[model samples]
Target chain A: MYIPTYEDMLAAHERIKPHIRRTEVRTSAYLNELSGAQLFFKCENFQEPGAFKVRGASNAVFGLDDAQAAKGVATHSSGNHASCLSYAAMRRGIPCNVVMPRTAPQAKKDTVRRYGGVITECDPSTSSREATFAEVQAATGGDFVHPYNDPRVIAGQGTCSKEFMEQTDGLDMVVAPIGGGGMISGTCLTLATLAPECQVIAAEPEQADDAYRSFKAGHIIADDAPKTIADGLLVPLKDLTWHFVSGHVTEIYTASEAEIIDAMKIIWKHLRVVMEPSSAVPMACVLKNPEAFRGKRVGIVITGGNVDLDRLPWLAAS
Target chain B: MYIPTYEDMLAAHERIKPHIRRTEVRTSAYLNELSGAQLFFKCENFQEPGAFKVRGASNAVFGLDDAQAAKGVATHSSGNHASCLSYAAMRRGIPCNVVMPRTAPQAKKDTVRRYGGVITECDPSTSSREATFAEVQAATGGDFVHPYNDPRVIAGQGTCSKEFMEQTDGLDMVVAPIGGGGMISGTCLTLATLAPECQVIAAEPEQADDAYRSFKAGHIIADDAPKTIADGLLVPLKDLTWHFVSGHVTEIYTASEAEIIDAMKIIWKHLRVVMEPSSAVPMACVLKNPEAFRGKRVGIVITGGNVDLDRLPWLAAS
Candidate 1:
C-alpha cells in the first residue's frame, strides 16, 4: 500500500494551484444555530469543472514532466473525475482519453467531451474498465491517473483541507464524505500536518458504508454492490487510501438516504446553493448525530454541485 | 421630493447594524473572464430574511420612538419587503400587520406567517390596497412603512453600497436593480459621498421600465399596471426615491424577460446561487450591454434570494 506524506501534499498544492480554482469558504449562521456547531463549509462545489476532483486531476496531469505531459493522460471514471481529468488535460494542451461505463450520466459524458476528451463507453457489469483504460494508455502512450489510489491524487485533494484551515482558524474537527477515500485521505494528511489538534471525521451514506465498515473492522472491506443517493460514495475504500484512513481519521459516521435528501433541501432553502447528494452527507451526519459535533467549530467539505437539474432528488415524489 | 444626506445613510447603517446580516461579497473568475469585467457581487441575497429589504424594514421598525413603536409597523407588499418588515417587527417584539394582495405567491405569504406577521388580504387593484391599508393603519395606529418611498428605508439600503465600497477598494461602476428605487437611491447616495467618481447604474426589466422612462423624461413616469418576471420590480418610483434617482443615478438600463432568465440560469449553473429574476437584472444588464462595462471594475448588488422554488421563471417551459 502506498501512502502520501505531508510534503507530497504541499508539493501537489504547488503543482495544482495554477490549474484549479481556489474555491471559497462559506459559513451559515442558520446551520450553526440548528446544530449548535459553528460550521465552515469548504465550497468545492464552486471549483473549476464544478467539483473537487479537479484538484487531484490537475495535480496528476501536471505532475508529469514536459516530455511525459506531451504524451497525454488517461483515466476510467463514470463521474466527476473523468470530466475533471479531461478538463485539466485540455488546459495543459494535452489529449485525454476516458473509459466510462455506459450507465454513466449523459451530463458527465457531455462535460468530458466539452473539455476535449475522447470517450470509450463500456458495460458496467461485463467490461473491465481497467483493461479498456490500459488499451487507451498503450495506444496513446498517455499516463494513467487513478481516480483515488494515486499518491499525487491524494495530495491534490489535501490542498482543499489546507485552504480550509487557512480560511478559518481553530477548527476543532473536519468532516468530509468518503468515496474511494481520495478526498478524506488528503484532507486527513493536510490537517494532521498543519492542525494536529483538529480531528478528521469521515461521512458515508449508510447504504454504501464500505469505508465506515472498513474503519470499524480495521481492515479494507469491499462491498459486492451498493446503492445510495450519494453515488459518489458507492466505491469501496482502496488499500492505499485505507493506510491514511487508519492512521489519521478519527471516526466514520453514516447517514440514511432520507437524511441526505433532507440535507440537500436545507442547503437549497437556506443557503441558496445547489448541492448534490454526495455533498449533503456531511450535513446529514451532523443532523443525525448532533451530540458528537455540538458546540464544536466544525468544518464540512461540500464536495460538489453537479446534480442533474432535470432529475433533482428533492423534486421527486416518493 | 426629498433626498437623504450622507449622514442620514450613515446613521441608518449604525441603527440597523445589529439587526441585519453584513452580507458577504463573492467574486467569480468565470464571470470576470466571460464579462471582460472584474465583477464583485454583493450578496444581499444572504441577508437576514434573505433580502436587502431587511435593512430598510429593520430601520423603519427601530426608528420609531417609544409611542410610535408601541403602535407597531405596517406595510402593503406582496413580496420581499412584506416578509422583511414582518421579520423585523418580530425581532423588535412589536406587532406587524401586512396588507398583501390576495394574488401574492403562497411561498411569500408563508414566509410572512413564519415571521409572525398578521396578514390582511386585499384585491390586486391599487384602490383596494390603498383603502385596506389606510383602514388598517387608522384602526391600529400602526406606522406605515412605505415599501421603498420612505427616507429611512433609502438610508437603510445605502449601507449595502457603503459596505461594498469598503470591501472592494475601487469600483468603476455600481449596478443595482431598480423596483421602487429605494435600493438604487441608497446605492447612489453612498457612492456619491464616498466614491463620487464611480458610475451608479440602475437595471430594470423592459416590461417594467418606469424608472428608465422617468430617467429619460426628467420627470416621474408611472406604470399603472406592469407585468414582469421580476415581481419585486413591478412598483413605480416614489417621490423621495425619484428625487435621489434623478440627481445621483448615472444611467438606467433595461433587460428583456429572456435575458433575465438567461442570467438567472447562468448564476444557478455556474455560481450555484439561486438568484431571483430581480436580482438577475443587474447581471442581465451587464450581459446585454457588455461594451458599456467591458474591461472595467463592476459592483453588482444581488438584492434578494426570496423566490418561489416551485415556480422559478427558468423552470417554466418557454
Candidate 2:
C-alpha cells in the first residue's frame, strides 16, 4: 500500500497550482440553517476540466521526468478522470490515450475529443478496459497513470484539503464521497497531519456501500459489482486507498438514491451550479444525518460538475 | 432624467463590496475561436441573489439613512429584481414588500419569501400592479424603489462595469442585455467616464425591442405589453434609463428567440452555468454577429441565472 507523506502532498500542491484552479468555497445561509451546521463547500466543481481529477492528473503529468513526460501518459476512465487527464496532457502538449467504456456519455466523449485525447472505446467490463489499455501501453510505451491507486495521485488530491484548511480555519469535520477512495484518502491524510482533531467522513451511496461496510466490519471490503447514479463512485476501494481510509477516516456514511437526487436539485436551485450525483453524495449524507453534523464546522468536498444535460435526473420525472 | 455620475458608481462599488460577490470572469476558448473575438464574461449569475440586481438592490437598501431604511423599501417585479431586493433588505434587517405579478414563477415567489420579503401578488396588468404597490407603500410608508428608473439603482448597476473594467483591462467593447435599460445605462455611464474608447452596446430580444426602438428613435419607446422568454426584459425602457443610454451607448443589437435559446444552451453545456433568456441575449448577439466583434476584447455582462428549472429552454425537447 502506498502512503503519501505530508511533504509529498505539499510538493503536489506547488506542482499543480498553476495547472489547477484554487476553486472558491461556497456558503449559503439557507443551507447552514437547514443543516444546523456551518458548512463550507469546497467547489471542486469549478476546477479546470470541471472536476477534482485535474489536481491528480496535472501532478502525475508534471511529476514525471523530462524524458518520461516526452513519452506521454495514458489512463482508463469513463468519467471526469478521462477528461482531466486529456486536458492536463493537452496543456503540456503531450499525447493522452483514454480507454473509455462504450457506454460513456456522448458529452463526456466529445469533451475528451475537444481536449485532444485519443479515445479507445471498449466494453463496460473491467477486463475489457484493462486488456485494451495494456495493448495501447505496449504499442506506445506511454506511462500508465493509475486514477487513484497511485501515491502521487493521492498526494495530488490531498492539495484540495490543504486549500480547504487554508480557506476556513478549524473545521470540526470534513466529508467527501468515496469512490476508488482517491479523494477521501487524500482528504484524510491531509487533515490527519495538519488538523489532527478534524474528523474525516466518507459518504457513499447505499447501493454501493462497500466503504461503509468495511468501516463497520473492520476490514477492507470490496464490491465485486456496484450500481448507483453516482457512476464516479461505483469503483471498489483499492488497497492503497483502503489503508489510508481505514486508519485515518473517522466514519463512512450512506445516502439513498432519492436523497442524492434531492441533494442535486438543491445544489442546482440554491448554488446555481451543476453537480453530478457522486458530487451530491456528501450533501445527501449531511441532509439525511443532520444530528451527526449539527453545530459542527463542516467542510463538504463537491467533487465534480460534469452532468450530462440530456440525462439530468430532474428530466426523468417529466 | 437622473444620470448617475462616475463617482457615484465608484462609491456604490465600495458600499456593496462586502455584501455582493465580485463575480469571477470566465473566458471561453471555444467562444473566442468561434467568434474571432476575445470574450470575457462577467458572471453576475453567481451573485449572492443569483443576479446583478443584488448590486442595485443592496446599494438602495444600505445607501438610505437609518430612519429612512427603517421604513424599508418596496418594488413590483416578476423576476430577479424582486428576489434581489428581498435578499438585500433581509441583510439590512429591514422590511421588504414585493408586489409581484400573479404570473410570476412560484420559484421566484418562494425565493422572495425565503429571503423574508412580504409578497403582494397582483394581476399582470399595469393597473393592478400599480394599485397593489400603491396600497403597500401607503400602508407602510416604504420608499417605492423603481426596478431600474431610480438614480441609486442605476448607480448600483454601474458598479458591475467598474468591477469588469478592473478585472480585465482595455476592452474594445462591452455588451449587456437591455430591459428598462438599467444595466446597460449604468454600464455605459461607467465605461464612458473611465474607458472612453470602449464602445457600449445593448443587446435586446427582438420580441421585446423597446430599447432598440428607443435608441433608434431618440425618444422613450413604451411597450404596454411585450412577450419574450426573457421575462425580466419584458418591460419598456424608462425615460431616465433612455437618457443615459442615448448619450453613452454606441449601438443596440437585437437577437431572435432562437438565437437567445441557442446561447442559453451553449452556456449550460460549456460554461456549466444556468442563464436566463435575458442574460443570454448579449451572448447571442456576439454569436450572431461575430464580424462586428472580431479581434476585439469584449466584456459581456451575464445579468442573471434565475431560470425556472421546469421552464428551462432545454426542457422543450426533453
TM-score of each: 0.91, 0.96
Model 2: residues >4 Å from true position, as ranges? none
TM-score of chain B in each prediction: 0.98, 0.97
Residue B120 of model 2, lDDT score = 91
- lDDT of every model, 2 decimals: 0.88, 0.88
Clashing pairs in 1: none
- Per-residue alpha-carbon lDDT of candidate 1 for residues A1-318, written as tens digits (9 for 90 to 100): 567889989999888888887777777666888889999888888776789999999988988898989999988888889989998998999999999988887888988998899998876853577677778888998898889999989999999999998889769999999999999999888988899999999999999988888899999888878999998888878778998899889999999999999998787777777778999999999989999999999999989888876566766752
CA RMSD for every model? Answer: 2.9, 1.9
Looking at model 1, give its docking quality level.
Answer: acceptable
lDDT of 2 at A222: 84
